[model samples]
Each structure stands twice: as structure tokens, then as C-alpha cells.
Target: MKITFLGTGTSLGIPIIGSKHPVCLSKNSKDKRLRSSILIEKDQKNFLIDCGPDFRYQMLRSNHERLNAIFITHEHQDHIGGLDDVRPINFNMNQPIPIYGLRRVIENLKKRFFYIFSKNKKSNVSKISVYELDDYKNFFIVENYKIFPLLTWHGQLPILGFRIENFAYITDASHIPFQTIQRLKGINILVLNILRKEMKHSFPFMLSETLKITQQICPQKTYLTHISHTFGFHEEIEKQLPKDVYLAYDKLIIYE
Candidate 1:
């Protein structure tokens, strides 16, 4: 299986508009992050996770040709803003793309993109099918691969993280429950969100806190995503991280 880090920055993204921080001012391409999202491909099937605000740009950058499904982590605007862009693929394929997510997420999508779900509203048609998944449910299986959802805390709100094959990607998480940890143990690759170096935000997991979780999960390789500009330059932060842990940058690809 192959995984691509489409975007690794948080909701505000790096270079936060008018900020004068040094990391944001850097000219390096890796420092210019979009938003948090990923692409997973195996066999002939291609799937997307969290089609955020930068979705169109990401697709163009990667020259993506196919999209079979989209799995959402939450209902946050930054996570689902680019959802309607899937319409192009649907039009080309002449079929509705299947989207899987928690019930609240599906409801939010319906409300936010009501026009797409409406049969009478045809201004800009969006051909897509929705599959509402329950927390901790086994969903959308491929041969030899099944996705397991783990309910996690993103501050006070419940969020979801997924494990597929030997790879697990979790983001926007604050605290992972003990029960969820039981399921996440012994994964080959683990990706989790680690925000600022200092913990002051409403979000749950800070840098050190996330690392402790990673140590317990003990994946062969751990990647930290959903980064903020406060994390410092990509090269500088990378030098300080443990050998097995990596700060995921946009467009980075991993195979397992």
C-alpha cells in the first residue's frame, strides 16, 4: 500500500496569511504547507482522506486521475470544504463517488452541501453517494485490507482516526481513549497530529503529549502532521525528532 501526504498543515495552514514568522518567511517549498489531508492508493482503487480547502490545488499538483472514495475524519470546515470538487471525477466516471464518515459528519455534509444532495437543485450538480459509518465500525473493505475506525477526542468533540492495512492516520486528535489505544497497538506506520510546542490551545494533544502516545503505540515509524508554524522550519525540527519519528511535509509519500 502507498500513502501520500497531500497537505500537513493545520486548519489555518502555514504562513498564516499576514504572519511575519521566520518559518513562514522561508523560501523552501516544504515550508509552504496547505491544509491537512492525504491520499491512499492500492490495487486499482484510489481514495482520499479529508478533502480540505486546498483540495483542488492538491489534485492539480499531484495530477490525480481517479478518486474512488473519500473518508472524512470530522466535520470541521477545513476538513470538508473542498468536498464538492469531487464532482469533476464523478462527471467523468458517470457514477457517484462513495463517501464514508461518521453520522454527524454525513449530516454536516448534507447541510453544508445541500444543493448536491437535492434532486431538484441542478445548478452545479454533484454526483456522490454517502455512507454513514458508526464509530469503531469496520468499513469499506478491499481484499486483504479492512479499515477500522477509532473514536478519539479532539478537545471535547469526538473525532475519528482510521487504521488500514498496517498504516494508521489520525489527525485533529486531542486524547485517544484506552480502548482506541488497544486497537492502535502494533501498527507499521502511525501518523498523528502534533500542534504547537507550547500547549495553550483548546486542542488536546501538544507536541510532547503526542510523542508519549507514539512511544506507547510503538509503530516502526511514526509521523507527526497537522503542524503549526510554531513547530519551526522543517529541517530544524526534523533534526531534533527521534530517529523513528518524522515531521510529515506536504507531498511526502510512504510505501509499506
Candidate 2:
């Protein structure tokens, strides 16, 4: 299986608009990140996790030709903002893309993108089929591939993480249930989120919190995403992490 870090920054992304923060001003490409998202490939099937506002550019840069399905972690605008940008793929595939999310998230999308959901939509509009995921039920994207949805929390909002084979992808998660951690024990490769070195909000994990959880989950390797400028320069801060931990940057790819 292969995984691509399409984008690795937090909601506002790195180099937030109108800011002169040094990390944002840095010339290193690693310091310049788009909103957090990833693309996963297993066998010949492709799956996208979190299509943020930067989705179009991410896909173009990576030159990924096809996506079999989309999985949403939550209903936040940063994660779902690029839902409309799937039109080109829809046109190329000549079919509706399948997207999986929680019931509330599905409802949110229908309201936010009412035009796309409208019964009499234009022929040129993007097309997608929505699937509601039950927090307690595992589902399959295909006959051979099973996707296990691991429930997590973003403050008070319930969100989801996923386990496919020995690999897992999770982001924008604050509190992870004990059952979820039990399920994730000994994962091979984990893509988890860490907003910054310290926590200023209750909705996401900080470096310390994520690291503690990492130890608990015992993944062979952990790639941290959903970063912010305050997390420090990529090259320097990354060097400080444990041997198996890494700060994932935009466009980075890995295999498991």
C-alpha cells in the first residue's frame, strides 16, 4: 500500500494570509503547507481522505489520475471545502464518486452544497454519491478492501479515523475513545494530527498529547500532520521527534 500526504497544514494552512510569521516567510517548501489531506492506494484502488480547500492544487501537483472513493473525518469547512472541486474527476470517470461520512456530516454536506444535491442539477455539475457511515460499523469500498472506521472526538463533536490493512489515517482528533485505541494497537504506519507544540484550543491535539498517544498506540512509525506555523520549522522540529516519529509535509509519500 502507498500513501501520499496531499496537504499537511491546519485549517488556515501554513503561511496564513496577511501574516508575516517567520515560518510562513521561510523559503523552504516544507514550511509552506496546504490544508491537511491524504491519498491512499491499495492494490490498484485509490482512496482520498479529507479533501480540503487545496484539493484541486494537491491533485494537480501529485498527478493522481483517479480516486475510487473519499472518506471524511469530520464536517469542518477545511476538510469539506473542496467537495465541489471533484467535478473534473467526475467528468473523467463519467460516474458519481462515492463519499463516506457520518450521518450529521452527510446532512451538513447536503445543506452546504444544496446545488449539487438538488434533484434538477445542471449537467456540468460535479456528481457524487454519499454514504453515511455508522460509528460502530465497518464498511467495504470493494469486495476485497475493508475500511474500519475508528471513532474519535474533536472536542464535543464525534469524528472518525480509519484503519485499512495495517495502516491508519487520523486527523483533527482530540479525544480518542479507549475502544479505538485498543483497535489501533500495533498499527504499522499511522498518520495522526498534531496542531502545534502546545495546545491553545480544545479541538485538536498538540505535540505532547499526540506523542503520548503515539506511545500508547505503538505504531511502528507515526507521521504527524495537521500542523500550524507555530509548530516550528520542519527541518528543525522534526529532528527532535522520536526515531519512529516524523512531521509529514505536503507531497510526501510512503509505502507500507
**Number of the top candidate by TM-score?**
2
Summarize candidate 2's per-residue lDDT along 53-96 as a digit string, tens digits: 99999999999867899999999989999988999998778888
Error of 2 at 53 (Å): 0.8
Q: Give one digit per residue, the lDDT tens place, for model 1 in 1-256.
A: 8899999999989889999999989898889889999999999778888989899889888888678888899999889998778878877788888888899889999999999999798587767788888847455573356888888988888888888878899999988999888788889999999888775778857888888999888999999999999888999888988879998999999987
User: How many steric clashes does model 2 contain?
Assistant: 0
| Alpha-carbon lDDT, every model | 0.87, 0.91
Error of 1 at 182 (Å): 1.1
Range of the 10 consecutive residues with the lowest summed lDDT in candidate 1:
135-144
How well does candidate 1 match the true structure in TM-score terms? 0.96
List candidate 1 segments past 4 Å from native. 137-144
